[model samples]
Target: MVQRLGSIGKLLVGVWLAGVTVATFVVIPPYQGLGDAGRIVIVHVPTAWVAVIAFTVSAVYSALFLRRRRPDDDAKATAAAEGGLIFTLLSTLTGMVFSQIAWGVFWNWDPRQVTILILLLIYAALFALRSAIDEPERRRRLAAVYSLFAFVTMPFLMFVAPRMAESTLHPNCAFIKGSDCNGITLQVGNVGLLGDQKVQLLGLERQGDIVVAQVKVSTPGLASEAILRPGYDLTTRSYTDRPTFPGQRFTLALESVNLERGEARINMEAPGSGLLANQRTLWVFLASNIGFTMLFVWMFLVRSQVLSLEVQIAQRKVALA
Candidate 1:
């Protein structure tokens, strides 16, 4: 009965993931600036999210192993860490593909990229440490302790560090609506920084229902400058045109304007910033997240069982010896 139920659950997960794949390509429309390359987000984001979950699961089991010294708990911890590593690798690979399509480069050493790479290295070291120790008990104890310390870095590396960087080209606004993602307000002749770019509002002009702001943008160190005219539609209360900055893929967008006050809120928008704003895209993205999470659970269960079996076999061999 348990085997039958497991089979049914596996079948359901397979069907659900297949549906997500179909919806990802067929249902969701191509993003405006990113084109079809934006579709990678469905897989990329979920894999990254699953990696975080897997690491957390591993940490929990590691703590349990420490408390009880149960071999099964250690097995589960190792299995979850393995799953986390695989998913993290997938996230990195898919991100590289997306980067190639959107940024015209495979690797740019962006802050997010650097942080994830560092995280990969940290976890990889844990496995290496486990393999070097010969005694099963010592290996498990040291790995449990190391895993707890490793987990302390995961949150900082994955979330906090990337956000702290001021000049990253990552589309943080796609998932988060933090103050950094929100644009800065500037009056005519006032200067402000938008994602490390210095911007001075030069002038504003009205053409029909559109309010156009002439923004003088300069890169860090005043190395390059350009005059950008981003347009906002007063009637729609949205940006009509986002002009790309000089020598960068990011665009300057007018978020809001107060004509009477001569002030405007301008921001730097990365490629695929508003990709999830579409109803179909958002629904499919959410479904994809759900599917990936379920898939992780399935993988973790199977892997942990196999690891537990191996541990049991090793114990029998030790008993005979």
Candidate 2:
């Protein structure tokens, strides 16, 4: 019965993974809006997440195997490592596809991609090392030690090594929103696309060169009238803001901002040149922040209700030991 249950568990995991693969290709938003580039996210994110989980699971099993010298631990570790390598390979491949689209080249020496590839190489080495050792007891011991060492080195390679060099691919840990290391440039970049690194511009696409909306926004507290700018010009079909059109998306710059009323007034020289929006940034930001904050609060409150005791017990156990 136990063996049967294990078989069922394996079947379930297989089915779930197959479902994820199907969902990525089969169920997606409008391709023209996001284009073929968006497909990269489905495969890329899941495989990378699974790869990390696999490495973590392998580490746990290795620790258990080392403690108990059990054959089961070795088997589990081998399974995890194998799965981890496969997922890592998938991540690397999908990422390369995205890179080819965003960058002119197939492979750019981006720190994030390089680090992921290096991780793959290290895991591959671990497998080779495991095979080289023939004695059963010695093989398990060596494999556990190697896995532990590789796992430790991963942080250094993925986080430390990448930052130590120049990168164009993923956002640095320093640029991550709400991160402690976020600099002034990161904050500015978050506000303005031009202020961001060149790579940030790669992701945006210009749908049309027409002014979508125009509004005379009047704030109750300060401004009498605020011109809400459009991302593109309507009449000329060219960018209202000159020199912004040679790229994927136009950067909308406006007149002086009114901080007191919390608004910016856009002044367009041409009336026929359309630059308007149906949905304003302020509305988008407000909705996003409210939703995000509520989610955080909900997660915290729920976890506090049920998980607080478990957390407290775990802390106490740590303290006692």
Candidate 3:
């Protein structure tokens, strides 16, 4: 049974490594529509997931080590935490890139984004705290307890943040998109390692219409504005004969915008045919989130063994002395 368990562990690790290769070399870039820049998602998303996983694993190992009085768990926790932090930083940078593309700005004070920055800080502090302690047992206990606090705090950062923001650029979205996971869930079938879901954005274009200019204005200023020609019908996604005046420039309008100082809820509509806007947000959230947690569970299991090995080596060295 022990040998079989070891074999199974080896197989799982091998497959995971292979999956990482596929995720990087094949799946991520094509799926996310990230162009050359999209390659970053593979690094960013996975890093984030790994980071969260690392911290979570560290906390768990800390708990287990406390209960069992084992040294191996302590080492494993440290390794996971270290790995997690590296991935988390990478993920943040990737996100900043996407933000620049989609929102026309590199950094926004969106609650979720800000929270990630905070989480990174906490983990950094954890590392410093661990290094500061000289006594091994004391270090383990302090690190584990801190990990526990951080684990407890992380979900609040992910969830509770958006509610507190008043005027923010971040979209308040959910994970799991409420779609029948029946087809998607089953098709992707326990393929937890494969998270290459695609998000599609659609807009109809006329034969000769030109995109003249894009103006992002304050809400009140949008109330009386007509950016596009009156004849162009935005709702039907159909328009009269395209105007060739502005050379390949498409004129788009935002409805219900403020002419003076109110918020402009730009009339971005959910796709009537395919996935809705809210649905997409939820998908992005989930596709990018769960792995974050699961990664730590991986760390917790792996870390315990490493700590034991260190204890053994230390004992041998002491005996030799």
Candidate 4:
């Protein structure tokens, strides 16, 4: 009966993921500025999120194995880690595709990209460590300790380090809004940093209902500079024209303007911002997340069961010998 229920659950997950794949292209609308390429986020983000969950699960089972010295716990931990590695690879590949379309390069050494590559290498080493050991018990013990340390780095690499970067084309704010993700405010003649660019608000000009802020942007070390005029519509209280930053696809936008105070909030926008603003896009994206999580659970369970059976068979063979 339990096996029957498990089979049913697997079938449901398969159906659910198939539906998500269909909805990704057919239901969700193309994002502003990104067009069809933005749809990659539906798969890309969920895979990365699932990778984090899988690694956390692996770490928990590894802890249990260390405390109880149970082979079953070791099997579960290995299975979860394997699933995590697979999902991480998927996330990286999808992100590269997104980058090629949005940034005109497959790899730009962006902070997020660099951190994820490092994470992949770290986890890959854990499996290599497991395979190098001859004794199963010693291998599990070492892997459990190593996995805990790897988990320690996972949070910092995946979350903290990328955000700490001064400039990144990753659209982190598009999915997860934060105070720091908002741009900077500058008054005329005041200097501020936006991403990697140093900017000074040179002046503001009003053309009827539209207000344009002339921002002088300089590269690090003041190597070069360009004047960007980002326009805001006073009547509509929205951005009118967002001009592309020099030498990059990302655009500079006037988020808000206070004419009386001679100040404006200016920010850099990547290609995929406001992607979830549409109702269909949000619903589909949420559904994709749910589906991928379920798929991860299924993979973890099946892989752990197989590993447990192998351990049991090995024990039987040793006893007979």
> Which candidate number would show the highest TM-score if scored against the true structure?
4
Q: Which ten residues in a row have the lowest lDDT in candidate 3?
A: 192-201
Q: For candidate 4, give the lDDT of residue 267.
A: 84
Structural RMSD, model 1: 4.5
Worst 10 residues of 2 by lDDT: 268-277
lDDT of each: 0.87, 0.51, 0.50, 0.87
TM-score of 2: 0.53
Clashing pairs in 2: 211-233, 211-234, 211-274, 213-276, 230-275, 230-276, 234-274
The 10-residue segment with the lowest total lDDT in model 4? 172-181
Backbone clashes for every candidate come to 0, 7, 27, 0
Ranking by lDDT: 4, 1, 2, 3
lDDT of 3 by residue, 131-233 (tens): 8998878988888888888888877775577556543433212111211111111111122110111111122222333211222222211223222221233
TM values, all candidates:
0.78, 0.53, 0.57, 0.81
lDDT by residue (tens digit), candidate 1, 179-287:
2576789999999867556789999999999999999987632355789999999999989888877654567888899999999998877555377889999999999
Candidate rank order under TM-score: 4, 1, 3, 2
lDDT of 1 at 232: 97
Cα displacement (angstroms), candidate 2, residue 291, comes to 26
Error of model 2, residue 119, in angstroms: 0.6
lDDT of 2 by residue, 161-223 (tens): 866664333422211212222221211112322212231111122345333223322221222
Better of 1 and 3 by TM-score: 1
List where candidate 3 sits over 4 angstroms from the true fold: 1-47, 171-307
- Encode model 4's per-residue lDDT on 90-146: one tens digit a residue: 999999988777655678777999999999999999999999999999999999999
